[model samples]
Target: MHIVFVFRYHIFFYTRCSIPFFTNDTFETQGRRHEVFVNKTIPMVVEGDDMSAYSQCEIYKTSLNTSYSALNMPPSNTSTEQCNKWVYDSSVLKDTFITQANLVCKRVIARANANMIYFSGKMTGALVLGLLSDRFGRKKVLIISTLMHVGGAFGSAFATDYIFFVAMRFIIGVSCTGMYSSSFVLGMELVIPSKRVAASYMLDMAWCVGLYILCFLAFVTRSWDMILLVMASLTVLLFVCLWIIPESPRWLKSKGRFIEANAVILKWETINGKKALTDTSSSKNTKDDIEPESVLKMCTIPNLLIRTLLIYLNWFVIIMVNFGISLNVGNMDGDLFVNFAIISSMEMLAYTFCFLLLNKTGRKRLLVGTLFFCGGACILSVFVMLFFDKSLYWITLVLSYIGKFGITASHSIIYVWSAELFPTKVRNSGIGTSSVVGFAGSMTSPYISDLGKYVHGSFGEVLPQVIFGACSVIAGMTSLLLPETNGKALPETVFDAVQFGKKKADDRNSRLNCFYTNDAFNKDELTGEV
Candidate 1:
């Protein structure tokens, strides 16, 4: 079953059972253990710039709370009626236009590629940025790619016609691919050991927040072109970030720039109030504290190849379900944008809950549990739509939402798991390739979503459900073949990867070595070694 986290204002109600906000504080007569920190200020996430091996990235901010609260409006005092009108009417709500726009863009772009016009400039852009970040640094890549994304967003926004708009969207896709991939890689390298998985999942959470932010922006704005213009204007943030962002010292050290990397680590410690490790150190406080193995070329290893395949398939699953449910909503009688926003908010909540349980539950249980429920939910949805009366649209919708909830959790698992699966050498390349495969799946979604529009057969809904259901089951089953990475140090090479799941007594690798981490540049105090 999909576990929904309903956070209380210290008061939890499980739909039926209500638990009051009971805390055992210092002054408690009953000697309860709860202490309320209401109105207490949490430390702000240090928002600034840093360069990783490939490029200089300026992190905007970070949060530890992965709960639905991340998507929540911080107790805004706005009246409900006032907020509703703006939310519905705003330009930010125009994300609904994207599906239509992207479809139009896809049709146009397909033609150019067919004529051998080298249409996949986005892939080229992605590769170039990947290498650029690797060679020049992650910080520079951040600045440049953000501009590329902004430019693409603007061009797509103001596209005069289908052809032009499609072309701009293509450009936008390329830039976004570059920015998204580069940012993900850099952000992982920036946080402490324990914070990694949560932070990684937060990337998607940020996407959700982006939608809400767009919602707010859309409310305040009017013109679609103006929205694009505003989006473009948001890129100007890169310039401001240049001052505060630090160069990726680890990347510098990886590229044989240790002195600079050391300086950067010192700066990180100064800002975060943690002790910096001497060059090449790591702590072992928890399993998460264990460092990642080095990256190796993806094509060179057998397990690496299999893992890549798994990652790509999972991504395809995500695209299939994400767009399928979303496009499914458009066929109904509702404000499509609001519905999509609600779905996005729900996805954010899924990510948040996953964050809380990820460490405790481990990856295997979560993946399996989510997938099994996802398949069941899809199957249930079909029956609801078939045997039930028209009055049950609400029920069918709930089932679909449940399926979405499952797929969203599965989708998140794919990204972080892929990262963990790869060695440092080919980590980016592996993910990059997986992304292309995922995009191939993504590119096909519109067509898949359109299948039922004019068709008479059950192929539209039934086929998709069957396919998704089968995929979910198969994907979950495949996870069993993979080893439990929980608390285990990442292996640096294919040899180590192959040997990872062997019996305890058969262990050749000490499981305690530095393996594949940037130990000298680490600041994970939890591990204590660093």
Candidate 2:
């Protein structure tokens, strides 16, 4: 399924940044590169007399000529937190983006910004690439996007500076949007509506698996460059596998390319050992009779617009809470790898919960319930941190995990809800718009988490929590306004979407009235005959 490929890219995007956490190396020589570590009694000379032997070089040339003694280095007095150079076991060797760019202490914001730029690119890409998929074709756009992903990953591995690394990450972000949006639309169009929830869960599982794999890879490699290179290499397999997949028949039909669509269907028929049932000419005539409307018309329909606004807010809240929790967890006081692994693993539970409950509870109930749960957990976490003793820190951790679980579930369920809400003519565009709005939340979340640390010590850490909890509550309540689409057929036009819920309500009332009237008539007839 195309979901699998897009899911791989999604996993890669989220997990790649965690590599720098383990791989950051403490500079053995903290200050200028030319500064040599030696015993205090021994004054090593490079090119000058004893008086000015170790004086700072005016030329600032290579430091290879200077004699240094790392073994007799000064005893460490400063804590690792305050020290410019950190002391680690000599056996642990790594090369990472943080170490290469020296992004520690004051420069740590650059690390977060790298993530920010990527989401920003995703926001832009969703709008641009979604339209491209509609105008050109899903297959063509997917290939182009996948190639870009491959190229960006390869380029990022060879980055010489933090700026270049961020730039490449942005490029990768854009490519991922293209691949994800195009492939998701293609896959959903091909599958029957009943199977969409299962398909979504499978893709979500694949994404979770990617994070688990990332954890193992980081443990073994312990080098950012190698990890990135390995991740990039795997995308090549996706590229190769894409060759055998057919263009989406729905997209082809929408574009009036019936011949190509028929051929693709025939290919599937041959594989399944079944005969073709429909003539291409007849299918073409049926499709041609219904003219496709402009995607922009989504804004003009009142009912569609109202529902779209709810979706937009829903997406924004989901992503804000999702990334807000994820980024904040890394900064929590704990083993970085352990924290990251725990957070990543929680997504599996969240998605699984949605899978089990989505059909039974329906989309509206699940989304609204999860959002309220997530918000309550977040607010509770803030109180625990403020009022509880230090020994009860575990309680705070527990609440954070619980909050993440609820938000993660909401994130997974929203995907299915948004897909079901839109009509066929504007589905991709509508989803793309919501995606851009959601990524905007992601783009801002890094800065919010970053600011939370400063607020934690000085301002009670309530600012970020207030924002997170409030957004969750508001978005959840707004969700009640949207229609439930459980077991309903996909709509074909804006008009169908507008009347979908009203029609359901009318049908239920009509059936109930008909039943009562028939019962009364039968009773009257029985009495007269007796």
Candidate whose lDDT is highest: 2
**What's the lDDT for residue 510 in model 2?**
35
- Give per-residue CA lDDT, model 1, range 363-465, as digits (tens): 7788888888888887877777677876877877777778888888877777677666654434455566666666565445556555565554655656567
> What is candidate 2's lDDT per residue for 51-127, written digit by digit as tens?
32321111111233443246432333311112233222222326566656756546656766766687777887788
- Candidate 1 segments exceeding 4 Å error: 1-128, 218-223, 281-296, 453-455, 491-530
Please list the C-alpha lDDT of all candidates, in the order they appear: 0.55, 0.67
The count of residue-pair clashes in candidate 2 stands at: 0
* Candidate 2 backbone collisions, by pair: none
TM-score of 2: 0.76
Please give the range of 10 consecutive residues that has the lowest summed lDDT in model 1. 1-10
Query: Which candidate gets the maximum TM-score versus the true structure?
Result: 2
